[model samples]
Target: MSGADQATRERLAEEIRSLRARRERLVDELVQSSGPGDSGDASQELQGGDEVAAIDERIAELEKLRAGRIDVQGVDPGTEVVLRFSDGSTQTFKVVAIPEEVLAGEEDITVTSDSPLGLALAHGQQGETVRYPTPDGAVEVEVLSIRRPS
Candidate 1:
């Protein structure tokens, strides 16, 4: 495995641990609230349930990612890139190692490492133009700048 692949595995494992802890906490909260006659705030319970479900989904995704081959090179989570579209419109996006991060609704626009744009960006260097296939067609984009994830 390459350094990037090992690094990605470590990061995914860390995220899984953190998410499992969070899921535990959410479950604990729900337990404390109990149900209808158990002095539970139904609204809070409902919200907590929703959060728990989301956490579970993320955990599953991360686990699958950790089990797979990590060949998405040159881009790790938090890697930022500025891309110039064919229309000359430039946009900055933070590339995440997994879809879980993007689903977390980060402040900056985010893309998964497996995404077409993300994969294309990962293999390209600064000032290089890369093409990604979209349902519409192949979209050509130029990488204006790349900030490696910390």
Candidate 2:
């Protein structure tokens, strides 16, 4: 596994832990509602219980992935690249070994390590040009820079 891949796995595992906490809280609530002598609306509680169980199952799957993680490594600490998509749109991003900063009211875009673009960017060097095959012909882009996630 690559260093970058290892870091990404660790980061993802942390995120899974956070989500698991939420799922566990919901499970506790469901267990309490399912206890005997409860005269409340059991149907709604049962629905919620099902949802919580599903989420817990999902978290468990994530945990399994974390345990058997494989990743790309040895990425330089100063890699940055500009991605030009097929829609004539472009964005610059850094291949960091950590999660991006949280923004207020802004959605986070987590680029998967398995994605073509992300993988290409991961192997790219500064000033290198990479061409990606898209549904509409091909998209060409240049690597402006590279950097660590820090």
Candidate 3:
């Protein structure tokens, strides 16, 4: 594990912690809003419901990320890696526990650790070629480089 990788893991852990805190706060607010003493406005209730649903979804996502969170010691989840395909084309992807919306607009691709390619590349090293099952057929990709999140 490199220093950079460790730093990335630390940062991710902190993010998870922060998200958990936010979720808790949201839950508390939802409870307060739905209390018996609260005003019985239909629109307000509907809005509160929507907010709770959204917060619940976010909490679920955060839990998934926490469950799949990776350490910095290996080519596991949470590592950013570059691969060279058999056709001589290269691409970079960040191996995550769950696909993050924040990475959707980024240059690099984000792959979940449970995905075929990510599973094959788990614990892989640079210069190693790993085979993963594809829709067309099995494909082999070589690990060109591995980088931790900045």
Candidate 4:
């Protein structure tokens, strides 16, 4: 009902902090790109400017997710889930509110809230089979289990 979950909020806050730090470093690079009485590298300046702008945009986006979001829909980021493919093969994935939430961790597979598969799985219960479209076509996956990360 609010924004992102607590873990997602913390990750977003950390990401903002990291981006800000990188932006500061980029700013310093921009300042150093040109020296007194020296011609500047226009290409480098433009690239740094673009990167800074992107960072700023991302920071703004993350800042808005500082509350509860997916929980209101019955699931949250950092939720570990098991799924069975149509072939009867099973795999585990950690559900995240955003693509950026895939941090280095034990869970290598991730499902973001914005993706088609993620959208299909949202608010799904165990034993529910959800279908989502992919470039190849539609795929069906059965939810085996869903639990918060320990």
Backbone clash count for every predicted candidate, in the order shown: 0, 13, 0, 2
Comparing 1 with 2 on TM-score, the higher-scoring candidate is 1
Tell me which residue pairs clash in candidate 3.
none
For model 3, the superposed segments whose C-alpha errors exceed 4 Å read 1-75, 148-150
* Each prediction's whole-model lDDT (CA): 0.76, 0.57, 0.67, 0.74
Q: After superposition, how far is residue 49 of candidate 1 from its true place, in Å?
A: 22
- Candidate 1 clashes: the total is 0
Candidate 4 lDDT tens digits, 1-150: 254456656777788889999999999988977654433577778788999999989887777655433332325656778999988899998777666556666345887756787777777889898888999999989999978646
- lDDT (Cα, tens digit) per residue for candidate 1, span 1-150: 233356567777898999999999889878987856633587778889999999999888777777764556546667888989888899898876655444444645787777888777767899898988999999998999988865
Question: Could you give the C-alpha RMSD of every candidate to the true structure, in order shown?
Answer: 7.3, 6.5, 6.9, 4.5
What's the lDDT for residue 107 in model 4? 43
Residues 8-84, candidate 3, lDDT per residue (tens digit)? 44555676677667767766776676746545554576776777677677666555544554342223556789999
Off by over 4 Å in 4: 1-7, 35-40, 67-82, 92-94, 100-103, 106-110, 122-128, 135-137, 143-150
Q: Which of the numbered candidates is closest to the native, going by highest TM-score? A: 4
Q: After TM-score superposition, what is the CA distance of residue 98 in candidate 3 from its true location, in Å? A: 0.5
Q: What are the runs in model 1 whose C-alpha is more than 4 Å off?
A: 1-74, 103-108
lDDT of model 3 at position 70:
34
lDDT of 2 at 25: 81
